[model samples]
Target chain A: GAGVSQSPRYKVAKRGQDVALRCDPISGHVSLFWYQQALGQGPEFLTYFQNEAQLDKSGLPSDRFFAERPEGSVSTLKIQRTQQEDSAVYLCASSLSPPHMYMNTEAFFGQGTRLTVV
Target chain B: SQQGEEDPQALSIQEGENATMNCSYKTSINNLQWYRQNSGRGLVHLILIRSNEREKHSGRLRVTLDTSKKSSSLLITASRAADTASYFCATDVEAYKYIFGTGTRLKVLA
Candidate 1:
């Protein structure tokens, strides 16, 4: 697609329920990222993937939060045994490549998955 | 933990007025980026200024970075009601990690 796309715009899950949110990055984009945004706060980094390999998952809140870019194009963030604290907007973003040496490689974001744990 | 902190958690301004937001970071960054979000939706990239380059402009958006002070400022000229949104500052640390700040909520009243 032209922009990053995320599935289940809104998800209401009961405590202990497992929920999966999906993301389809822009075609041919090699870098993908997942972030968690709590109410009245900035999006916190959850994980990053370069192609199909997850380069970083240090920011995932806990074991309950798992993310994968199986084919490097589509990605999923799964939260198992969802807790109330897990309620937030899960955002997916993709970029052409690392901006380290590149002049500009801005991230394109998805509308985000709003997950509510009841 | 966040690498940057934004000042003035919220701001209310009249239309046509200029709006300014500031962000301060702790570590060295390859570049600093500004993004805008409306009603908690997806964020749109506004502008980016490299660490070596002090300033950059995009449309009415002007961004200035002070690597020595580890701070950056975003200025929106002649803000409009449509400009109301949450503005966040992110820093690309090392090569991969992009750390975001708390963000500044801007309200431009018409």
Candidate 2:
């Protein structure tokens, strides 16, 4: 794809329903990131991936949030037992640099998936 | 937790006037970047400044970094109404991870 792509631009799930959000990064980008943005706030880091490796997930709010990038090119963020607090925009970004580099490069962001848990 | 916090949560300026926003982070960082987002849109990368560098310029945008204070600022010169958007500063605290600030909402009135 020309830029990062996310599926199901908007989602509304009932409480306790499981949801999956997909991200397809630009071809061959080595680093991928997922962020959660609440209304009237900035995007918060959730998890990071280097190639297919899940390197950092310190920001995932709770055990209910999970993300995976099995092929290094595409990623998925899944939320289990959704709660009203889970309503927010989920963003995905990808960069060309790996961890070893200074990572001075910029990452392209997807339009994001807005999840509304009711 | 968010690594950075921005000041002047909301700003309104006349078109053609310069607009500036600041960001301060808590931890050491490799680089700082600014991004713009319109309503219901994805972030658009503006500028990236490496820690070793004091400042950087890209077209109408100027970014400065002060690692000592863990702060950065973005200046948009001769702003246009089209510049109306939210601006966020993201810090690379560690490898492959970026922590974003609360963001500054800039409204450039025409």
DockQ of each: 0.76, 0.78
Chain A TM-scores, candidates in order: 0.96, 0.96
lDDT of 1 at B85: 97
Model 1: lDDT of residue B5: 93
What fraction of the correct interface contacts does each predicted structure contain? 0.76, 0.87
> How many pairs collide in each candidate, listed in order?
0, 0
Q: Would you list the C-alpha lDDT of every candidate in the order shown? A: 0.91, 0.91
Across A1-118, the per-residue lDDT of candidate 2 in tens digits comes to 8999999999999999999999999999999999999998889889999999999999999999999999889999999999999999999999887754454578899999999999
Clashing pairs in 1: none
Model 2 residue runs over 4 Å out of place are A100-103
**Per-residue lDDT of candidate 1, residues A1-91 (tens digit):** 9899999999999999999999999999999999999999898999999999998999999998899988888999999999999999999
> TM-score winner among the candidates?
1
